[model samples]
Target: MDQERIASAITRVRETLAEHAAEMRYRDSEAIATIEAGLRVKVNGPHGASIVTDMPNGVGGEGSAPSPGWILRSAVASCVATLIAMRAAEEGVDLPGLEVMVDSESDDRGLLGIGAVPAGPLSMRVIVRAQGTSDDARAREIIAWGKAHCPVCDAVERAVPVQLTIELPGS
Candidate 1:
């Protein structure tokens, strides 16, 4: 990891926030996906990155990539890990090995239309591990701070309103 670059980026963000308190609100970003084949989609990220998602063979898909639920869980884990690193850097703590694992129980009954279960994960668990000079108490404090400050963690823990609209070709 490039500690210098990470520190510089964090410093820049802090400076920007201090300078533009009222104008720092970020606009909504979006990820676009298009159907490729049966139960398969090609997702395009804001950057040049792209990924493919497909269902399991049992679900009548080719199982090319991971399912959406797995992707969501991975996103949560990655976000937490990044936030932890950033927080540690800000606090002058060296975390040479930081890892985050996110586990969730997914209920597919709603998707299958076999039951009335929720369409999302039933529950989630997050585990963070890192090696640092700070004591256990300070480590706990950092984890707590990350949980409270991480946007993805907050979104997962809270209820977010989602509005879906469908557009048909030629009206």
Candidate 2:
């Protein structure tokens, strides 16, 4: 990991936000998606990037690409992994091997409309594997700090307001 670069970047952002108080309120990203084919969608990410998402054969999709739920889980796992690396860098700790895994439990009855259960995941588990020399306590501290500071982790764990507007061709 590039500790110096991460530390420098964090310092720059902190200083910038401190000076520009108005700019400190919002730090956000966006993704847009449109239905492509049966149970398939084309998503546009930041900077003109793109990805395809499709449901499994059970859901009438061609199984061409990963499902959206899988994508969400992957994002959670990767985001936490990144947080760990950033934290390590900031703390000047060296971690040779780091692995993070995320799992979520949900009830299909919610989606199938067979029950009143929520469609969202009912629970989530995060597994982290890494070791840094300083001390076991220090390593735990870093990992906890990373997870606690992770934006995705926080979003999933807490409730955030979503403002959405849908436009139709003929209304």
Candidate 3:
């Protein structure tokens, strides 16, 4: 294991987070609501986009909108790819033409109105394809670093904490 390389990767990610924190706060400056079955987000502003996401049933839309779950999966894969590239570069591992596909599965037993079998984002599998010098070794390293660095993967693996507030009509 390359300790110095790993340290460098961590430093770069920290710096990136610090650099983007303010911009994120500025851009993500709205709030929304949703029920327990899923999450409905209403980002107010001309540039904001309103999104309704559910577990498996799908994201509702007016006229041919993509499913939210699919979007989420895409986001996960994209994040993994980005993190892998960044970590691999820092680790002195050459990576080229990298692409990742994320797949998720959920059982519909409970959704069929049966007993409460508990449904959620069950499992996510990632398929990575890339070519470069030291491709195999870099692929291995990227697989490891991707699981460690991706925020979406972290949210899925580590279970991020979320707090919800609802406004009452009379209040």
Best by TM-score: 2
Residues 1-171 of candidate 2: C-alpha lDDT, one tens digit per residue: 379999789888879988998866765677888999888999997888998999889858999999888888888889888988888888888766789999999887787777789888889999999754657777788888889988888988999898878889995
Off by over 4 Å in 2: 131-134
Give a tens-digit lDDT track for model 1, residues 1-171: 566678789999899999999998886667899999999999987768787899999989999999888888888898888887778777776766778889988778978877788788889999988775557787777777876788887888899987889899997
Tens digits of per-residue lDDT for model 3, 1-171: 454566587898789889898665443346443443334333333366565444323423332334555777887999998888777756667667778989988666644556776455578898888776566865787677876879888877886777777779997
Error of 3 at 51 (Å): 6.4
Give the winner by lDDT: 2
At residue 68, candidate 2 shows an lDDT of 86
TM-scores of all candidate predictions against the true structure: 0.89, 0.91, 0.63
Each prediction's RMSD to truth: 1.9, 1.7, 7.0
Better of 2 and 3 by lDDT: 2
- Which candidate, 2 or 3, would have the higher TM-score against the true structure? 2
Order of models, best TM-score first? 2, 1, 3
Model 1 stretches astray by more than 4 angstroms: 132-134
